[model samples]
Target chain A: MSERINSAWSPSSREKERAQARKRISRKQAVVAAVSSIIVIGSLLTIVVTSPGWAVVKKTFFDINYGREVFPTVISGLWINLQLTFIGGACIGVIALGLALMRTTKSPALTPFRFLATAYVDIFRGAPLILIILLVGFGVPALRLHGISSNVIFLGTVAVVLTYSAYVAEVIRSGILSIHPSQRAAARSLGLTSGQTMRYVVLPQAIRRVVPPLLNDFVSLLKDTGLVSILGVTDAVRAAQINASRTFNYTPYVVAAILFLLITIPMTRYTDRAIRQRTNAQNAEGAI
Target chain B: MSYVLELSHIRKSFGNELVLNDLSLSVQEHTATVLIGASGSGKSTLLRCINLLESIDDGQIFLDGVEISDPLINVDEVRRKLGMVFQSFNLFPHKTVLENITLAPIKVQLKSKEEAVDAAMTLLKRFDLADKADQYPDRLSGGQQQRVAIIRSLAINPRLLLLDEITSALDPVLVNEVLSIVRDLKSDGMTMVLATHEMGFATQVADEVCFLESGNILERGTAQEVLHNPKNLKTQDFLKRVHQAGRL
Candidate 1:
């Protein structure tokens, strides 16, 4: 019986030919893409090298000796950026989770909290991150509140966490809302309390669904950590600026940029790979 | 003198649409009560109200003489004594069949994992689902998934089980398998209130049948009386349509 089923299930000659045709077309497209990218990059490089402005641009930006001389200060400054990203990212995760749950709760007693959460998300998401950093970092200190630290790094971290938490909260709330209502019904029908249902059943699935997008947010937040230099915390960009102004060379800026890319590129690539895997899993489930 | 489950003048509505209106019902202990109605006749809503999944606009529901539908009543406490199965078999997709069965037993009932797993395995083996216990709901056929859903509800050892169109979403070939599970539950003296469209299965398992029309019980009698000798014109008309469709 198994042999008969397998024999009848094999693809016909026409179907096999169609499959081969599709493979051939895809292979031809790959070759075209590869050739086009090489030609475009090669011609652009050649033009830049042969251009009249090439010598001055290279001396200002690509001077290897200047880059080496500024590397120590910029690397030290980059440590501050990493600290801000990691610490602020952790604080944002906690605050964002609370805000997301508040915004998504159906209880009438929580209406005020939900309203506040919604307002915070709307205002912060609508405002620019830099504007928020400037306002919080500068304006809070201007208030002269008792015992409040006016330190640039502390203020800057607080600003970044506040701004990013709003965006992350919105992402998490969307993930929670995307879950089918039937899942909640099923959980509640089984005698689980609403809190228990959310904690054990709803949240695990919601967090899994939002992981790729949440990682995407972290990548952006890591880059935004550079904006803290505006508050005079002497992070990578600030260090690069001091070096470039004193030496009349742009090499330190390139060094700082390379350092940022070193972290963000790998993270962005992982997020993309996660997204692809999620899509493939969904497609496989749909086919079944 | 107290019925096992009773609804008194229950009223429920969604927005401006009245789904159930002044509905009252009672089920004796260890008896199955099957609700028969057309698509929008409020059978599912009535069952949902009984399980406290839907809040009644005005009414009282009694379980063993206690008023469970009062606003001050803790719904979670009431739900623990009642089990419900849905039309689409809303088994947790992330959980295996055994895990699904054991989740409520362990989490809400506070049974030890070992005890829950043992009970779950016994039930799975009885249902011929022991081989599929480790498989997810998506990996099972619709019939198997529905059986697992029933088993999941039973794991709670509920006083009453509410089945809402449990066989409606299944294919005709698979419907018999799910219906047979209900039949076995009936024989085991499980108290159940089921909303179903299966007239033949209803006749076989139900001690009493209630024919609902526009959210009111138009007729109530033994299963044979309602299915074969319905008096109300609406019930007769509904049965005629079902018979002509060859479903009865």
Candidate 2:
């Protein structure tokens, strides 16, 4: 109490933190400025190119304004990519949680179960994913093991789900172990059943700590979904490639690149903010 | 006299090293007994065995005239009747003070949440932490949190309350707060068994004080007899060191 009184400065002498915070430009203005800078830099290049009569340089991004003919296909392609990512990422998350629990359970009787899950992870993560896609897409029907038929898109979906869940499992295992043993003890001491303690006490804190890392995994899973298009899934990336090949125009590749950015850019920004906020919390705790 | 709890010839060994060897004591109903000893003297372990927090390899523990250490005894039922507070003030960090107090009553006892909260509120108010009802354990002072832990145990309305060095973790200034709450508990006719190094707490609140060395109860009697004129040389030496430490 005495220390606080001594540390306090005169009202007029203190700097206004809010006023200082207000001095930085807003995010909207920063984006506006960046876009304008790109335009200015492009026009400078165009001016230099046309003056020199360089044929290849003459069609700078500024001089060549390809009309809005490509807009509809590009927009649809981005929408398809977004939908694919959400579906694939959700499947990976749901499967990863079960596998992570399998990896950590200690019962010797459940050893077979644990080994099977581990083998699944090791095989998918170790092999080339492209081969796994072809094997699932082609081999299943040829084997005639059951009534299953050849479904390329279904097989592609299965391949992506299998590949990403292993990495997600590791992410989840770290989350569960990060909780203090005392937290679980406290729950057990209250006479809560083992499962009840896990569900109510342990998982809540562990899941909170893992959210940012899980978000990172989810975003990565979304990006990996584009690989599925190679297995004839007709996803955004595949559609763009088909159009590009047919017309022999480079526009489709550019369109696909934009499609990727549309999904990845916002996802990256959200996870970045969430992770930074958590990191800053850790730093504050260290300061204390 | 009908005793609330009796541990006879209790022997516990963790591998080769014996933590408690033939330790025995009887606790009377509504009486406060304090166990005093140096570090690693098995005083805490002996107290923990009564509540079955730690199992005893040999010997018998009887609670309320019923043998509790028997193979047929249901430990969960025994634990419901026994409440323990730790030196570390093991308040659930994620829970509020009131919720920590109310959790076991609702969860284990199957009492309605409203009924449990009412019982918890009384303990919180008695501990002068009613205002801290919604505050997390980490937000409270060490003394306040320890008191909350004590109140949390008390809310369960245990027939026997075991306090294992409850005030040792508190600051010097905060020690008195916890001790006074313990003293108040005794005055209110609560039956409690405590393990403490503070000779003065033993003198002020305990009806019987036991001097422990290694795993044996070296001496036990009325607080006045043990505190003022102990017969054992070890007891005298232990109290002398306690006094010197307090002075320092």
Candidate 3:
């Protein structure tokens, strides 16, 4: 009986043949993938390089020396974009959390605030980001508010924070709503006050569920900070605009685009990984 | 004697569907009261009403002889003295077993973190769940999760514990583990009101068994009197059906 059990557990010659067949199929698949990718990408590259205006296009957009020369200024300009994103992102997180809580609150004391939050989300989310930036940038300065600085950077940050807060708030609210009501009942039954329940039980879970969406907004916020360049904040896009117009070469524009991609692509990959990890965590045993 | 819990003419409705109609019951201190009936028989609603989870449309509830059904009463304050375990074992998925058990003690009762953790560890150890203290609910079997939930409610030292079909969601193999904890709690003299479909378990644990039909307790007696020799026809029919279904 022991011998039979061991034999049953061990891999047989039939199993070895099945494994060999699987390896053969996988090898064939890899070869096919490589051949198709090489053919498609090589043809596209050839078409672009052999175009009639390739010389002019390469000189204007792909000039390595000019790109190297402008890199420092554009990088310094990117420092401003980075500052805007971090500062604006922090402000948006706080404001959006407040808005989401306000919208979801059942307290009669917050009735007016809930109405205001709903209206704010509708207005800002419906309007384009650039339009809000232009309005707040030029409009706030025009109002000549005493305490508020007329600095385009400050004004631009405010506009970005305001618009992004609305979008992020909706994402957060959806997460809150997605949680089963039974969770709230359990918390409440434990004698946690409604506010405590929201703080301890609901918000922690809600915010966790919305992290990937929040990261997506963060990436968009980084790119949209370039929109502040319109207000003459000298961010990466504006710096590229200044350099490109000065030489009329357009290589600086390409350089700035590449810089933005350098940051965004990794963030996008991280967001995808976060989403996959969350899905796996949900399905995996002992997941925290 | 002042009762641990009392419901007088409690009436509740959800959008024209009457769930509990003029229902009333009382529980004595340190006694286990078991409610048994078929589905939609108002056993769960009565328990919910006692815990103040469901607002009474018209009635009075007295917890330890205080009229808690008054509209001006703070429901949260009342809930602090009562513990409830649900049919689905609604353990907070985000929290570890120990954290789930300690949450109410730390937050609601305002116990020191060390004190709550000590109490939680004691309960978990006693329940054979000390090893699962750091595991999330999804990592544990349904029985283990339900045991943790019972421990969570006990951490607050509630005067009255309300259990709404606590073992209804567990598999047959898992039900005994969960029911055994309640058996232990009964022997330890915990005041409890539970609705269940387990007739054999009810006979073992209940000091009093109430048979509910629609929204009324049609029969009330000791489990031997109620389960084995029910007087009301509805109670007998319900028991016969349950027995035929192999649940009794």
Candidate 4:
């Protein structure tokens, strides 16, 4: 009986033939992929290099000396962009969480605050970010409010934080609502007060669920910080504009583009990886 | 005898739909009362009402003869004496099993973290779940999650435990692990009122069984009388269906 089972389980002639066929197909696929990549890339390269516009395009956007000349200016401007995004992102974190919590609160006393939060989100999320940056950047200083700096960087960061908070608040509110109501019941039934339940049970789960989307908003916020250039904030885009006009070459803009890509690409990858990890964790739980 | 928990003329409705009509029930100390009914029969609603998760439209609930349904009474204080296990086993997904169990103990009961952990460890060890202490709920099986949920409630040492369809969410094989935990709780003389679909397990553990139909108790008696020889036709028909379904 053991010998019979062993032979039955072992690779038969048909199984060997199938395995050999699979190997052959995979090898063919590898060769096909390599050939296709070469053909597609070679043709694109040939078209670009042989095109009539190639020389002007290279001279305008890809000049190595122009890139070198603009590198310091664009990189320095990126430092400002980094500072704006980080500071604005941090402020958005606190402001958005507060708004989300206020909007979600069941307290009747908070009704006006909830209305205000809703109004802010509706208005800001609907309006353009550029318009918001322009208005806050220029408008706040025109008001000449006491203790409020007229500095473009500070005003630009405020505008970015304001607009992004509306979006981030909605993201967090959705995450909180996505949690099952039964979780609240479980917590309350354990004698935890509503505040304790929100603090200990609900918010932690809600925050973890929203991490990916929050990171997405942060990446967008980082890119949108470039809009501060319109306010004369001297961010990467503004620096690129200045250098491009100075040398009459678009290479500076390309340099700035590369700098933005360098940061946004890594963040995008991290978000994808985090989302995959969450999905895998959920799948693993379901499997067991 | 004064009951551990008592409901008088309990009434609850959601929107325009009345879920529970004028219902009244009393649960004795150290006794298990199993509520059996079909879906949408108000079994879960009744449990939720008793736990104060749902406010009664009109009624009075008394825990240890103290009126709790009154608006003037502090609901949180009333809830402390009651432990509830939900059908979905809503363990805090972010917390480890031990953290899930210890949260209410430390937060609500004001026990030291070490004390809560000690108490939680004892319950976990008793349930053969000590190994899962550091694992999150998602890492555990449905049965294990449900067990951890039950342990979380038990950790508070509640005066009365309300279980709402606790085993209804488990697979056939996983049901026994949860049911046996209830059985152990019964043997330990824990005062529990449970709404369940497990008629067989209900018959085994219940001192008294109540059959709820359309927000009213169609039948109520000793488990033997209700489960084995129910007097009402509705109760008999329900049991016949249960038996046919091989659930009884």
Candidate 5:
């Protein structure tokens, strides 16, 4: 009887035929997908190459020599954008966390601060990023405030931090509010102080839930750093602008765009994968 | 003997709906006091009030003869001496079983990390859950999670344990495994107050049984007195319904 049970559990000859049929279907699906993708992309490429103005467009935008000549300068300018992103990102994280906590706190002592935090988020999040950058870049130095550096980079970074902090704070606040009240109840009942509960139980879970959104904000922040080029910070976009105007060729602009995509595409893929993994983890039985 | 826990004229309400109204009870140390009632009869609220999870609208709660209901009393201090288990098994999903058990000990009780982990391991091993120590709460079956919750409560060596319909959310087959741990705690003379629908288990464990109806304890006596022979009409009616449901 045991031997018969073992045989029953093992794959049968019929099962092998079913498996082969499934493999055949999957292989057919892959071939169809590849053929359709090629047909669509190939047609689009043909249309572009056969356009009436294709010669002028290619000469201006796709000049390999011009692209390579501006590569070093564009790459150097990207270093400035990278610096602003890391420094501005760190500042935004700390300030946003404080704002989120202030908004979420139920303490009567923090009531006025909560009101202030809400007003801050409303003002910054509502105003346009470029407007904020322009105002801060040109306006702050006009104040003639002591100990304030009127450096365009400093002003641009400050403006980015202010606006992004508001947006990121809202994302974090939503994550915090998404946690069930029962979790707080459980922690509090276990004798954890309200502050301890927030620090130990709520924040860890909230931060984890918002990582994908946070990464999306990071990508936006990186792109928005280019807007600071208007303040003459010599970032990638500004460097490309200088080169493009000098030669009357758009190859440098294309080069800068490609460089930006090189960084962002990998980041976007990582964010997508993170979101998929989180969804799968949530749906899987016995997942942690 | 002085009671381990005493409540007098406890009143609570949510909006216009009064959940517990002038309810009063006392629990002797090392005794299991089982509260049997219909849904929305204030059994869970009563336990919550004792644990200081809910503030009483009126009246007083005395834990070890101290007036914990006083406005100036530190609630966290009161909660440290009491353990509570919820019906939903409110285990922290982010923490491992061992971390769940040790969190309050290390953070609230100020025990060293090694000391708390050692104590948590002892409780886990005794409860037959040592292997699951590193597993998150979601990875465990309902029975295992509830057992770990019980162990978490026990790790603090609470003066009184409040169980609010703990097995109500469990599957019928899994309910016995969770109840058996409570039975073990009972035999070991842990002072306990439990709200449960399991009358048979109540009969085995309860030193005293209280039948609550509409936010009032309508009758109180031994399990046989309350279950087999009730004096109050409401008690008899509720038990008859429980009997018809095959739960008594």
Candidate 6:
């Protein structure tokens, strides 16, 4: 009678003993793996330095300009690409929300919606983004639908949204479904309608779970906007390409790459911090 | 006593399997009746049927003498008057206990937030958990959360309480606290129908005890008569096992 349910979830005596033994075994295994990995990495580094390639790095580091002057055009183009990436990411968010909601429904009325999402993702993600922009820039007027004005920037934005929405939709759906079914039941039992349940309980939890992935998607979406250069959208990559054409040097891409790193580095740091926070919370509860 | 709730000849099926067969039950105003039976005895199904949570293929249910067969009967209205406590507390995890209690009153019933909070505060206090009113369900112990759940249901000021194994999830030390609260409700004369395996509580406090087996009522009588001198063999056998389990 001494609070029997306190024992409800705690493991029995045997389980506790087994868990302790397993921890000891794993700790020993971890030490062995760490020692092995250090040895292998040390050998590889030594072999690389002793090889002929070591001289090339020394030659380039000394002769080449370690810090080249930043070009204004490259900086301006980098800014333009940032704008396009953000704009494209925003559209992905809205479309992903819609597609995620549609994926949960079984109604025949939503068949076209499901099919369209599926088809768009397959077509663009299957073929490269370069081809999609080429099609949008060339195919629309080529089909002669007769005087339908198409902007390259708009077309690039649309192409990315279409391609990324399907992937984002799957991420969001998993987030939504990961929520305990009890949360929905509690909302319903409290007299909130199904729509209210989704809006309040389901969406809040889903959004929290998807935040890291959403940030990752945004970082990648920025890189993917480089493909819009083929459509002549004048984004960062396109501006770099224009500069590279004029200078007859690939050095312009290095500028665009730096800008891309600038954008993604902060996001990666934030993702790591968030993951640490989440794991810390779980481990804290586990300890309790 | 006038009947506040009644179910007549209810039958429910899932494909080929019949779950509730020709089941019928009645509740008098301001009296607690506890249903006792083994697992698969359809006790939980019967509770769901009472609230229309589970649809019965063939049956009629009446709340306050108004039949619920017509499409016009608002299920929400019936549920508002018949508070139910589930085995799992099922409190909204994201919401604090005060918000959990006040949500229905403010949103569905259209009461002002101030009014709903005022009412919820009283229930939280009565459960001796006023300090926990701002805490989420996950922050509370299982017993404390279950007690909050009971109070949340009662916050609606239901005409009758339907408890489905209310104390089943409780630790042994916390079981009496819940049962004591239930026993105190009897003094207030709140009408109730409890589905429970707590034989001692059923024998000591219930106005009537109904023994159900396989979706049918095997025996029923006043608590004293059913516990002390059941005439049916199934009832006697059930009592013997119940006692051997140290529950009688």
CAPRI quality of model 5: medium
Q: List chain A TM-scores, every candidate, in order.
A: 0.89, 0.75, 0.94, 0.90, 0.94, 0.71
Q: Provide TM-scores for the models.
A: 0.91, 0.79, 0.95, 0.93, 0.94, 0.81
Q: What is candidate 2's fraction of native contacts?
A: 0.21
State how far residue B93 of model 3 sits from its true place (Å).
2.3
- Superposed Cα deviation of residue B187, candidate 5 (Å): 2.4
Choose 5 or 6, whichever is better by lDDT. Answer: 5
* Candidate 1 structure quality by residue, lDDT tens digits, A55-143: 99999999999999999999999999999999999999999999999999888999999999999999999899999999999999999
| Best candidate (score: TM-score) | 3
Select the stronger candidate by lDDT from 4 and 6: 4
The DockQ of each candidate is 0.77, 0.31, 0.70, 0.84, 0.72, 0.30
| Per-prediction TM-score, chain B alone | 0.98, 0.96, 0.98, 0.98, 0.98, 0.96
The sequence of per-residue lDDT tens digits that candidate 5 reaches over residues A59-98 is 9999999999999999999999999999999999999999
From the highest DockQ down, the ranking of the candidates is: 4, 1, 5, 3, 2, 6
Q: In candidate 2, which residue ranges exceed 4 Å CA deviation?
A: A1-75, A101-135, A139-151, A247-251, A279-288, B14-16, B47-50, B65-74
Model 2, residue A277: what's the lDDT? 94
The residue-by-residue lDDT of candidate 5 on B21-137, one tens digit each, is 888999999999999999999999899888887888999999999999998999999899999998888888888999999999999999999999999999999889999999999
Model 6 alpha-carbon drift over 4 Å, by segment:
A1-72, A105-134, A137-149, A243-251, A279-288, B69-73
Error (Å) of candidate 3 at residue B159 is 1.1
> Residues A1-288, candidate 2, lDDT per residue (tens digit)?
335565666545235665455555576688899999999999997787667556543332213233144556656755655676677778888898888878777768879989988997788779877787778777776887776756766677777778888878878878888777656555555666556666666676667778898888777766676777777776667776776566555566665676677767898899999999978865753311
User: Model 6, B49: alpha-carbon shift in Å?
Assistant: 2.8
The global C-alpha lDDT for each of the candidates, from Candidate 1 onward, is: 0.92, 0.78, 0.92, 0.91, 0.93, 0.78
Best candidate according to lDDT: 5
Indicate the residue-level lDDT of A66 in model 3: 100
Between 1 and 2, whose lDDT is larger?
1
lDDT of 4 by residue, B101-219 (tens): 99988998999999999999999999999999999888788999999999999999999999989888889999999999999999999999999889889889999999999888989
